[model samples]
Target: MSEAFVKGCEGLPWWRGAVIYQVYPRSFRDSNGDGIGDLAGITEKMEHIASLGCDGLWVSPFFTSPMADFGYDVADYRGVDPIFGDLGDFDAMVARAHDLGLKVIIDQVYSHTSIEHAWFEESRQSRDNAKADWYVWADPKPDGSPPNNWQSVFGGPSWTWDARRGQYYLHNFLKEQPDLNVHHPEVQEALLQVARFWLDRGVDGFRLDALNFAMHDRALTDNPPVAEPKQRTRSFDFQHHYHNQSQPELIGFIERIAEVMNGYGARFTLAEVGGEQAAREMKEFTHGQDRLNSAYGFDYLYADKLTPQLVREAIASWPGEEGEGWPSWAFSNHDAPRFASRWWGEEERPRAVKTALALLMCLKGNAILYQGEELGLPQAEVAYEDLQDPEAIANWPLTLGRDGARTPMTWTDSACAGFGSTDSWLPIAGPHRAMHVAAQEADAESILHWTRKVIALRNAHEALRCGEVEVIDEGGDLLAFERRHAGHRIACYFNLTAAPLALPEVSGSVLLATGDVAPDQRELAAFSALIVETQ
Candidate 1:
């Protein structure tokens, strides 16, 4: 078995500097050979995750969903999707993860649910049913347009005219995912029950998905338009999303969730927030004594370029101070494009991958390492015919599409890359076999090995885990910072570009270094990252 999972400093919480590997359930593995991944598959792969030296695993939603929004449209909170596995399989997976000393954190999309949900079904039946007000419903305008100018993140108006209720319903995402009316006391109580259900199931924590969208203004006010960019992607991009989301009442509900989590021992909760005001809302959602443990903003997720300034700005936001919530960072995840493809050129990717891994570990907040990242996998080339993601399909050429990042994992050089025997849901990446786990294990110098080494180093050093990050330099291609905690300090330097350069006088013992650099050498190779033990 892998080394027992170690967390943070004694007084600090376990999640403070934890490195959690995100496993997109469908793309991780397939045990039944049904061309789809399941809980059994995740169970079989727990060792692979633990072996990576991550403290825990964050499994994407496998709840009963119609696959309309690819499991984000959860239909039943208590049941596992048949395609993924049953409750028995889920229990076994959680047990195995604990045995390997890896905590299991699952996705909870509390903001919305599948339109087919029992709550929505009964609520849409009439205006005064037992659960009629559980969902956001309203009357259409006199002209028969939506009730307001709110827009869906997917496309079109946020309000959908439902014939059943004879009123418009709110859905910030796809119509299949109707927004939950958190204003109702009953809805809040039921969601708390859902949280309690998962905590009792041996799971260690939760990643609340699109949490900022949980509540909206009851006034049905029209969102004002924003100007500037000539080209817009979707209707949601046309206006500032002030009215439809990020309400003041949201904080109380978050505190309520934290209250539920406190009943379970050492349980962690993180909010996933995005969009224009994410930075401000993240602070609001996670701040204070009773809110969530931490939160992540989309600072690096949609970044057009990887500059030293971008890295500096993102890390500078989360200062470890009184009343400020802890920060979490995700360079890559299920929804966003792979960082390697987004930030580096082909020839530079090999070195850049290792440097980025070290950089992520050096950051102060908890990190979410996407699955297949250790293998240095790029965005898969998906043919138009094999497209599965609805967002990609709707926009086509306009968007880079999330489908490219959701492909199957490559485990071998065999016919199907070990994900399954038959054709998988999304095709395996063309170049993925070269960096498969089997091949990486055979090569000690592989990025996979480097990733394991860096994660181990981060865990061993207290400064890297529970320290305050002080930016030392942010100029040109070079970025440097020092992490300090309880008199222990580590200085991290990185050459994030393809151009080789000479380094300044290096002091302290070299903890971990990538590229051609002897102990006495001062020159840094292209895309080199080195961590030095500073006095």
Candidate 2:
């Protein structure tokens, strides 16, 4: 959880420093033995989330889609995909969640829609159609090539030739997921209506997907070339991506969205901002209360390793200033390889994960815990033949691909890891089965139980929830800080390396401890963490 959701922080908004759980629908659970998770499955599991002490659950798109980009390409913004369930199931799921005191935040892919969407179908048929300019369209250059040199994040050129319209359309991702011309007033209104549709249906808020790419520079100018490219796999990584995304025009639309959300009671907004200018855009999109409630960057998601320097830099980005929008942090999500695999070797994984969670919960921003994170699930190994993510397939072995992170969540030691009666949409990692919910639930010392305890601890402390952070020590492999709220102060110390270190002598009552620590409180084992209440 971030620094905005303390249990006893009177008069403060519930979402200020709330902890949200992200559930990738297809891999979360399968109820009807269809090898895929559905709304019913998520509803059945709401109790687990509520028990975990999360403020809410953020469900990735379940809207009608063609499975291109796996639900990011929306065909119908209002309709739930049949594979997931119908609208009735969605309403029921919302009801169950509310019943369990959990807020529901659904993903909104306003930047683009599937090529099969009604608006796109009409717009692509001819330039004279009612929705002709609904999407970003341009003519070929005099040489009959693309109008600009912008590249798609998924690979190849961002523009695709359209025979019917005789123009090239922009797509920052899969060609099937056409970018929307958000600059158009009509397009912005249409998206707001989509938000209204969901808000009326009782969703607590939204997690805007790839929000920074929603608008592009209208001049169709070429993206500048990178001066120094590093270990590039796709052409997209070689460009500076200036004109292609993170346009200033985006802030206006974000304000418009925030206006609509303001009309609703306590509705929250979170943007997933990624790019070379992510830090800048994150601040821009969420500058004030009138804009997005908060935004999360890719600092931790794509990091090759977790270091004291990394934590220091990330926390420094947002100081929780008076008018500055709050921040959210995630160690693992559906898109990147799990942090357990990225940050530590097999021998240190268990203790490292525990300390990581303590660090995450103790941080100043909202914390987003992805499904299976509580169980210390690492990235699964999905063979090439079983791969499903488009970006991963395009880059092949060069990229780890997102499929490994999107594999089925382990529920039990039974066949299919008790995820479903049939084979899951993706195979379960063999090792994950041993760490399933059932096994961990029975073991009092398991990561799953520890996750609950850490979350509860955060909820019980006002200082940890929405406190101001002071970095006391970020030297070498040790990171120590204090979270201050009102008159209370809590000190958090972490040994990030794989070797024991002398503990920092701080006068305070012991609040929590993870990993091996000498009884005398003089030393901390590798990957250990200690939390102290100094006031």
Backbone clashes, each candidate: 0, 9
Model 1, TM vs. native: 0.97
Model 2 residue 178 CA deviation (Å) reads: 0.5
Cα distance off (Å), candidate 2, residue 272: 0.6
Candidate 1 residue pairs in backbone clash: none
The ten-residue window of minimal lDDT in model 1 covers 1-10
Q: Residue-wise lDDT of candidate 1 within 292-354, one digit each (tens)?
A: 988977888877677789988888788666799988888888888898899887898988989
Location of the lowest summed lDDT over 10 successive residues in candidate 2: 1-10
Predicted structure 2: lDDT = 0.90
Candidate 1: residue 34 Cα off by (Å): 0.8
For candidate 2, report its TM-score. Answer: 0.98
For every model shown, what is its TM-score relative to the native structure?
0.97, 0.98
> CA lDDT, every prediction?
0.87, 0.90
